[model samples]
Structures are given as C-alpha cells and as structure tokens.
Target: MFDKIKNIFKSDKEENNVTHKNAPKEVTVPAHKIGPKSQDDTTTYVIIGASIAGVTAVKTLRELDKGAKIIVISKDENIYSRCMLHHLISGHRTIEGINFVDGDFMEKQNATWIKKATVKEIDPNNKKIKYEKDGKEEELAYDKLLITSGANAFVPPVKNLREAKNVYPLRNIEDAIGIKEQAKYAKNIVIMGAGLVGMDALAGLVEIDGIGNLSLIASEDRILDKQLDVKAAKAYEDKFGQKGVKIYKNRMASEVLIDEDGKVKGINLGNDEIIDCDLLVVSTGVRSNIGLVEGSGIETEKGIKINEKGETNKPDIYAAGDVTGTGIWPLATKQAEVAATNMAGGEAVIEDRFEFKNTMNFLGIPTVSVGFITPPDDTYDILTYTDGDNYKMAVIKDDVLIGFIAQGDISYVGPYTQLVKEKIKVDNLAERVFELGYSDFFKIKEDGQFEW
Candidate 1:
C-alpha cells in the first residue's frame, strides 16, 4: 500500500504540470475586502474548521481560483495550532502567538471567516449547511464544501468522570486555558493516559510553580508505548521522575472520585488503588467530528471516508485533516491541498499515506520516530548505536530499512525520514546506519537544487 502511494506521488508530477490549465487565471484584488459574490464568482467554496487543514484549503483554493468565494466556518474564534496548545499552557506562547498563520491571513486571502459558529447539519442534497451563530441559526450555500472539522478529545467511561467538574481534556485552546487556570490552585494534578497529548499536558505543568503532586497514569507498560520502545521511554520516564513527577504505568482509571462540590478529588484505579487528584486531564485519544455527515450519505468508517482526491461519497463534498483521521500535521496539510486543487478544477491526489511518524521534544530531550518502533517478528534485523545520552536504532527487513528511532540528538531526522518513507536499502552503506546523512543521497542539479 505504501509503495503504491509513493509511486502515485512520483507519477503525479505530470498531473501537477497541467494544473494551471484548469485553474482560473490570477486576478488582483484589494486586501481586507471580501466583496459580495460577483458575476464571475461562479464557485463558492465553504470550508468547515479553521485549523491547519481548513486554513490551508482556503489559501490553496484562492490561489487556484482567484474569483471563487471562500468561506471558513469554525467554532473556534481564534485560529491557533492545536499542537502548540501545550506551549500556551506553559506560558511559552500566548493564544495569538500560537497561531500558525499570519495575523492578516483572512484578509489577505479575501476569505469570509465565520467564527464561534456551531454546525448543526450538512444537507448534501440541497448543497447547504445549517449552523448556529450567536443566538440565531443560519444556512450557507456552497458549490463545494470541505469538512476539516477535526477531532475532539475522548473521555473514557469512568464512573463520575463525565459529571465531575475540574476535569479537562487537552485538545483545544480553551482546554489549555482551563487547565492552566486550574493548575494554579490545584493541589494534586493527575493526567490520565500517557500518550502524546498526555505527555504534552505533563510537559506544560511540569515546570509550573506551586502545583502540588503531579502524577501520570498510563495503561501501557511505559509512557509513549506507541512512539518509543521500553528503553527509549525509560529515558523520559527517568527525567520525569527526577522532576518529581509520579508515573503509574500499566494502570487504568476505573472511576473518578468527586468532592462534595462535584469537583474531582481523586481517582480509583482498576486495581483498586486510589490517588488524590484535584484536577484531572483526560488525554486517552480523539474521535473525528463526523456528526455533520452522519446522515448526509457520506461513507464513514472510524472517520469521514475520502478518495485519493479527497472527495467524499457525496459529490462536491470533501473531507480532510482529523475529520478523515489522518492526524499527522503534514499529511493533513497535503490532503487539504489535494482537496482544494480538485475543488478548484485542478488535478491532484493524496499521495503519501505513511502515518507512523512522530517527533517529540520533552524535558529538553528531542526524539524522532519514523515507521514502526518494533518489528513484526524475528525475521527483522535490529541495529543500534548509543553514545552517552544519544541513542539511534534502525530496524531492517530484507536489507530494507523499515523503521528508525533517534533520541537525545535528532540531527539526522530528515535523512532518516526520507530513508524510511522511501523504503531505501541500507545494507550497501559502508558507514553505520547512525552515520547516515544527506550527503549519501545528495544530487546537485543544474538549476542549483538539491534532489534526494
């Protein structure tokens, strides 16, 4: 499947060459002006959500079809990177500072942004969407619709977990603000689930002053089990331990203990252990926001289904980003661009579907994991290089590098990612896998461009 996807990206170069043929001619327009639909504005592109995917789609559509109307509908008032919410909680960045785009992005794109609006339903049959803004409901028509509604944090079905107050999930900017506010007065803070988001929550509060006992509960044997091996995870576990962060591994929160005021007081573990918790941050996982397309005749399994062109089952409707469950930031951006190009009558397809890639920087320790962390069976050969705090590991199957992990020093992440994504064979390399660099694959073209 991955080889096929990569081949598509290589072959699509020809398709991209003809994109401008179908694309509308460039038109100069005044900045900060979103005029009424003109006679030439035959296509109205309505996008849902305002994060990476929706925002990228807006920019791509405008660049492809200058005269097309672009409307962005989002429940979030401010457009900020959800990935950087931890920075906001740690006071490393403000709400405005976390924005991934420029301050005048909407104005520059000549797009209409409808903020703080709740989408009620998507009427594919009528080519309209019913959404609620302020106190009234309104409907918006569109020639093409892109759903980048993203995902919502999932809270487990622990007893009293839903009804308890002072419990938050670190998924949105609002959640970050609430967590930061509560952390100020929290006596004992417990973060449930030790995945990426759970670790992010820990990273945000680890340095805060006056916070009482900080604890992390993970159902897996070690933290970040999906992203790192036991040894790699132990490096971070040791760092968190040194910082007085209590970690309970192989445990699950069976119930939420509440105080008299319905605020979280403690949590009961599945093994009958109880831990005090003034504030609880749930980061188990996330589920796509597919409610709008529930009855809109769009096929969905786990998330909104889309073809290579980012088209849903329904015509003129597309889905991208977390709504399609491609949670990776880079993949979401690529999917949005593909959807936008197709919507603007250009030719494009989602080419890269490799998802097992993640980078982490916690406690000042940088790490990058690409492909699989563990081999499927004993047929794979594993190589390792370690020097002091720096560690690098490579998994090879049939001479082809299948997975890689770099911890402490991740300078070779780019080459490692390329090698992994392209399924390059490393058996011929005279140098060790850890010594791999860009020079190994560097090719200087006549145009002074470096190709790998």
Candidate 2:
C-alpha cells in the first residue's frame, strides 16, 4: 500500500537557521491557573496562546530580560502541537511525543502558564485584560501584551451538518482523539477539503488497518491546489489513488446525510452524487481568532493588523503568530521573536524576506517546493525533470533563480533555497538547468562567502 508513496530512503539534509538545542529537559504538563500571581511585583509580559507563537515569545523575552514577569494564557486545557496532532492519530507518535517545546520549557523560562482561560476584553487604557475561566471572570494587569490566539477551523455551511452526531473537524488534540476512536468502528469515512487539514487527516486515516472505504471530496479540481501545480497535483493524486482513498473533485457538498438516529451516514454533493460513510471529517481551512481585538480599536484586516515590530495600533499591545495572518511555522517563530524583543525594550524588526520554500512528508512521499512553482505567464523560463514518480520544476525569470520543486529527492533543497534567498544570478548556467549542486553555480571562498 505504501509503495506508491514510499521510495528509497535518503538522509534529510534540509534545515533552517533557527535552532532548539537548549530546550528545557524536564517536561511540565500544562494545567489551569486560577488567576494572576499576587506576589509578583515585577513588570508583567502577558501573552495569549501557549502554542508555537506564545512559547517562542516568552522564551525570547526571558532571554532578553530576567526580571520581567511573563504570563502565558492558553484557552486549551493542555499544551499540544497543532501540527503534530496527525502523528497522534496515525499512531506514529504518542501524545507525549508531540510536545512542540522542551518539556521543562515553562519552568526554565520562569513564565507562568495559564490554561483553559479565554481573554474577554483588552483594556488598553488601564493595561488590564479581563478573562473568563471555569465560569469565573478575572483580570490580569500587564506592562505589555501579545495576542497570539491562533485560528479556529472553518466549517462550511452544509444542510443538516450540525445535526449529525459523527461529523468531526480536525483542529486540536481532542478532535484527533475523537476521530481516532470513531475510526475504529467506522467502516466508511468521508473527508471534505483537500488542503493541509484534509491531506493530513487523510494521511493519518490511511495508516489505520481497520479502514475499509475512504472518500475525499473537494471543490478544487485537484488535491493541494493551493500548494501545488497541475503536474504536482497529479503526482499526489496517483499516490493517493494507490492507497484506496477515492477522491471526487470539482464538487461541493450541499448536505450532510443523517440517519434516523441523528448520526452521520453520507453527504449530498452539488452534482447529485451521494457518498455513503459512517464518519464525516471536515478539513476546510481556518479563520484567525481576531475577534479578541475587534472592538478594542486595534487595526485589523483578515488578521490582526500590526507593524514591523508587531505592535498594534493600541499602545503596548502587539500581535503575532496566526493571529497576524501569516500562519507558517518559521514565520510564526520569527514574528514571536520580533514581538518579544520590542516588548523587552530591545529594538528588532520583522524583515521582509522572500523564500518560497516549503516541504512536506505526506503519507510516505517526500515533497519539497521552493520559490514560485507556478508562473503567471509563458514569458518566464520554466525547466522540469522527471524520473518515474520523482519530479522537479524550476521557474526562472530574467536569469535569476526564483523557484523550483523537488518531489522525491529533496537533498538539494537547502542549496536551492539558499540560492533564492541570496538572489544569485543564474544567467551563466541557463543550459545547465535542474542540476542543483554546490560546484555548478558557486565557489567557496576563504571568507566563507560563496562567489557566483
């Protein structure tokens, strides 16, 4: 079953500049805190969301200033990796193994962790935040505030969807747990959407041995339409087809079928196609939780609007992570760092950097995409290479290395990403396309700089 996706093993050599080598060794389980600490007389740096953004902010702030108090409030009861929830469903990793930061992260950073708490109102005038937890309202004072509330799953409007008992949305640990438990007894499962959520959900579901029939429906003509072009989508389609996951595209589900007992049974497509299934999983994208700052007079668009320093229109208030509308891992971490630095009285700016590099190991296929895989017009020079299921496409304009995609062997991704980041001129090597190597376009100098 894995042959179509799996291939010869190769050591992963792609990595970014960030490092997490010194994360706390002792792991601390997240728990609820009733309110703010009464004894702490120091300056408070309050951050919302204990996921990647919040954690990174507190850690970075702690390193810059030791005396300031850092408080992290999370609406969830426990801290878990949103990205690793699929690993939990697939049984490839235990719940404990999905910790995004080191176990002892909070303790080492000396930051107070508040769980299951929702911020109700942000009072910029008094520098106070009113929150509700466990049916009680409380207020916490802060010198600086960072909102990283993240996003919530967006479920499209479908008739009778709310009435279905077995319909689920994959967003957090609890959602993954519910889906995993339901999959045990479910003989047929229908998944909606083909984006990241749907793809990850399908990846995990296919790993379960008891899965009988799997169906995926999306409005796009191909899977991962937002992330991949036609050829790349075809590659993934073929791989998914080999796994027995039936896919229906160019159709939107109009109604969710419910049995007499109010349980999910199937779905009615716009084209009058009905897919029968015992479980329905909705993976339609997400919407940023920007409502927390909506009425507070802070600027916002699709996400909370912010400046280069992550500062909102309100004084001493900033935003980061998915709430800022940029929802990628590396960018999220960088935003957190920049927000923390300015909050700690240090000067830092979130520089505008362009490197369209993203990699994914969906199912067993190693896919790497760099720069612009799709060009708007035919004037751009496009080069491609294919070997069986392995594929590569390089998009070039004006003799500069702009974008490329390496599906199977991604060992060359690091160098390719570096070339794009550096904006190296490739006019001299137009004929030597798709051959990414160190010696092909660069020469190492004694000063550690590579000459083009």
Best by TM-score: 1
Q: Which of the numbered candidates is closest to the native, going by highest lDDT?
A: 1
Error of 2 at 49 (Å): 0.8
Off by over 4 Å in 1: 1-39, 428-431, 435-452
Give the range of the ten consecutive residues with the poorest summed lDDT in model 1: 16-25
Residue 172 miss distance in model 1 (angstroms): 1.0
TM-score of each: 0.88, 0.86
RMSD of each: 7.9, 7.0
Give the alpha carbon lDDT tens digit for every residue of 315-352 in model 2.
Answer: 99999988888756556666777888888777777774
Cα lDDT over the full model 2: 0.76
